[model samples]
Target: MTHLPPSEFTLAVRHETATLTVMIGGELDYGTSGDLLNEVSQQLTAGQPPPADVRLDFRELTYIDSSGLTALLMIHRRTSALGATLHLDNRPARLERMLHLTDVLDHLTAPPTRAGGWQPEEDDGLTEAGMT
Candidate 1:
């Protein structure tokens, strides 16, 4: 059996006002997914107040697997619980396709719901049956 070289991954962080951007490069697979998660967790919980926005800059990212997708979901949950918005920025075609295939693109990018649970959408006195 041929052994494959371990994937090389890198993360760079930047802070701007209430936003924290993590620039990801290289492959994000089973072996490196945890690193990304841990770094984001540390950043999220390291201060008096958490960032209002967390952006995962994927412009430099080259590859990702299921583990990486799972990490994204976990990060989303963390940010949402902290009342922060999560942004998956500059996603490449493959990443976008994976998100769409898994049907999680909406969940990962939607604004966190207000406290007290789900809110009803505004009704302009219109019904699906077409009776206003």
Candidate 2:
């Protein structure tokens, strides 16, 4: 099935110590993944000792496709190769389900809790639609 190009999305960057956080919004499908990939590449190549950690905030994202998942995997591989950790933060329910069903959640990182609370258990790899 063909998916439409993303109509809207935004990217922002912030730093906390050696960690660089990239906040993403809107659809992350074929048409919009490049923007994310480019942003990551720029940060990695900017000569800043390779960020100790890279966090992707997807709280506002509304959609993601297989291509989008591929883009995220690419980011993971790139960061792993550079010896940096990649953290996924505040994922919306739909996207979280997709990641779990694909059995890739174990490969991704979650945001640290502010109050030093217990870590939530990893997702069971199930989506609300019951597709796995």
Candidate 3:
């Protein structure tokens, strides 16, 4: 049997006044998804007024399993409870299809966001890219 690399996931958090952006990289599986959970929990608990928007950028996410999906769902629930919205950005085509097939896309994705000439400064909040 071929051996695969040990599961590793990284979450890069950028907290802003109105938005908290998390960029996830590497594999999001059972072994690594908890890091995401804890990070989100800490951020949510620490933000005094709570962020109005929670953006998850999966551009570098190589793979994600059911447990990863569940973790994302948890984030969704927490965001909703705080009266905030969640946005899934830069999703790969296959991953997007899988979310659609699993009927969980609506729970994680926000409406499409617009792109403009401006770029994000270091602390400009969660910058989103187009889904298509």
Candidate 4:
């Protein structure tokens, strides 16, 4: 069997007053997902206010496995708990599909919308119906 070379993972960060963008490249698999988490954790724990938005730029990311997806979920959870937004940016088509297929795209990019996102102040005429 032919063996493929291990994937290379690289990370870069750009920090602004209210935004932190992390650029990721290469593969994110079981072997490298932890490193991603660690890098994000370090920045979050740096004592300064957590950035209002923590964005992951996947413009150069080539691949990601389930473990990598889990890492993203973890970061999303932490950022939410800290009142920060988590954004997945510049996702390649495949990556976007991966996240969508795994049902994590919305979790990472936007807050979940409630089943009934809005309700009218007035109720429907159900009570007026004889069934009431």
Number of the predicted model whose TM-score against the real structure is largest:
1
lDDT of every predicted structure (CA atoms): 0.79, 0.72, 0.72, 0.73
- lDDT accuracy of residue 6 in candidate 2: 51
lDDT of 4 by residue, 1-132 (tens): 998886579999999888888999988877777778778767766656667789999998888877788788877766676667888989988788888798877768775332222122224332112121
TM-score of 3: 0.76
Task: Estimate the lDDT of model 2.
Answer: 0.72
Tell me each candidate's RMSD, in Å, in order: 11.7, 10.7, 10.9, 13.6
Q: What tens digits encode model 3's per-residue C-alpha lDDT throughout 1-132?
A: 999985467889998889999999988777777778668767876756777788999898988887778778766766666667789899977678779999989867653233221211222232111100
TM-score of each: 0.80, 0.75, 0.76, 0.77
Candidate 2 positional error at 91, Å: 0.5
The residue-level lDDT of candidate 3 at 31 comes to 76
Q: State each candidate's clash count.
A: 0, 0, 0, 0
Q: In terms of TM-score, which candidate is stronger, 2 or 3?
A: 3
RMSD (Cα, Å) of model 4: 13.6
Residue range 34-117, candidate 1, lDDT tens digits: 788778878877764788899999998889998889888877877787778899999999899999999999999988764222
Q: Look at candidate 1 and tell me the lDDT of residue 25.
A: 92
Candidate 1 residues lying further than 4 Å off, grouped into runs, are 1-7, 114-132
TM match of model 1 to true structure: 0.80
TM-score of structure candidate 2: 0.75
